[model samples]
Target: MPGAREELIAHITEKAVFHGDFILTSGKQASFYVDLRRVSLDHRVAPLIGQVMLDLIAGVPGVSAVGGLTMGADPIAAAILHQGAARGVPLDAFVVRKEPKDHGRGRQVEGPDVAGRRVIVVEDTSTTGGSPLKAIAALEKVGAEIAAVAVVVDRATGAREVIEAAGYPYLAALDLADLGLEA
Candidate 1:
């Protein structure tokens, strides 16, 4: 969480990026947007974002892996894998597809098999908590012993309760206030 959190947030803010004012995937409205893929694709920002997340979950016990829905969670998985491997934590990763890939493999979850694995679902943002919940369902279906759900930003929504009600812990590296960007 060291350099990555500060530097990555700075990059996102300085970009002054816009993705159009439209309904969010969670049906929420906002004056701004986070083009996560754009930021995640940044050669520098992506790895740091992943490292921040790894540090966010480092204290959590029984966490055998890190992962979540694709697109939002893709770079996160890769970053965690790289950091974990480097640190000898053996943190595996899995992807919970938006829908099962209908093509070859016919797979929904990708990466280390989650069956009975202690895992953590990661997300870049949380508005209504829908995305993380969907990933949770996918992991549960595969017998994944999910330890928790973590996000880089919480957006001050009720995502924490939603995840807690499902009997999994929730963590956020920063809330809207932390970056002085909250409405």
Candidate 2:
């Protein structure tokens, strides 16, 4: 896992992270940014994300499914779902849209039905836990038992407290310190 950690950190540092002044999705300003999608969608690196994430969540006891908010969570969920299959473990994937689709079934939760399932929300990076927390709220509305919350990179903001305050364990594959960008 150390190797995986090192490799991902290097890949992210070289390809995804930017050291500069910018505003984040959460309306917060930062000296750096981590655009994990740069690496999350890559054919080669996606599996590494999946494997490392899957390894972290493997012992959660009853995770029948994994997913999170859209855009960012899309690839992470897909990769983990696929990687889980390759590892002889079947796990479903779901997405929590910004709002329920205006047409069709008009469901906010997409993909497999998550009702009564043990779900772990996933994300590419967590700043304030806003997006994943939104996903958790949506999933809870549908009766999905959130086993935990997982992130590829945790900026070590208040996300840990925010997520745990919502009553679920927060799991991070990497953190600001891990990326050598400790706050």
Candidate 3:
């Protein structure tokens, strides 16, 4: 049997990868798209994603929480939180809204107080690195020290360069080759 990471890759390749023309969040055109939600939200695949991602971010030290821009990052953070607990890692998860809520506390970063804590921004997949960058900005406003940016699948389309150029270490669990795709 394949290990957690390999199994997760298989799941993603089989269920998440879609071919043909597609427009990515980065406003770039692509021949293929990796819709991780197709498997990230699945019960069987979620745990696999959590395990694989945990291993991917193990090198980064002092990560108290994990999260990123809403929608894409939501499930990935939840998976890490649950799986980390199972492994006794004790990781908290947060959500970064595109914009601050107008009501209640009018907050943007939701969940535990990440203020002054180290966090790893996560996403299901990365294209141009815009989403994680946006999340990093919100996290900075709340005083969260970003340890790194982690993604499940990297399209190999300059996201790594964009993120590293912005001064954050970028980590990816899988890439286009791992999914039998190309940039």
Best by lDDT: 3
Model 2 bad stretches (over 4 Å): none
Error of 3 at 62 (Å): 1.0
lDDT per residue (tens digit) for residues 47-119 in model 1: 7777788888999988888889887877777787887887787888878899988999987898878898889
Q: lDDT tens string, model 3, 51-159? A: 9999999889988899999999999999999999999998999999999999999999999999999999999988889999999999999999999999999899889
lDDT of 2 by residue, 1-183 (tens): 467657777888889988989887778789999999999999878988998899899889988999999989999999999999999999999999999989998899998999999999999988888998899889999999999999999887789899998788999998887777856
lDDT comparison, 1 vs 2, better candidate: 2
Root-mean-square deviation of each candidate, in angstroms?
2.4, 1.5, 0.8
- Candidate 3 regions off by >4 Å? none
Compared with the true structure, all predictions reach lDDT values of 0.79, 0.90, 0.94
- Pairs that collide, model 3: none
By lDDT, the candidates rank as 3, 2, 1
- TM-scores, one per candidate: 0.87, 0.95, 0.98
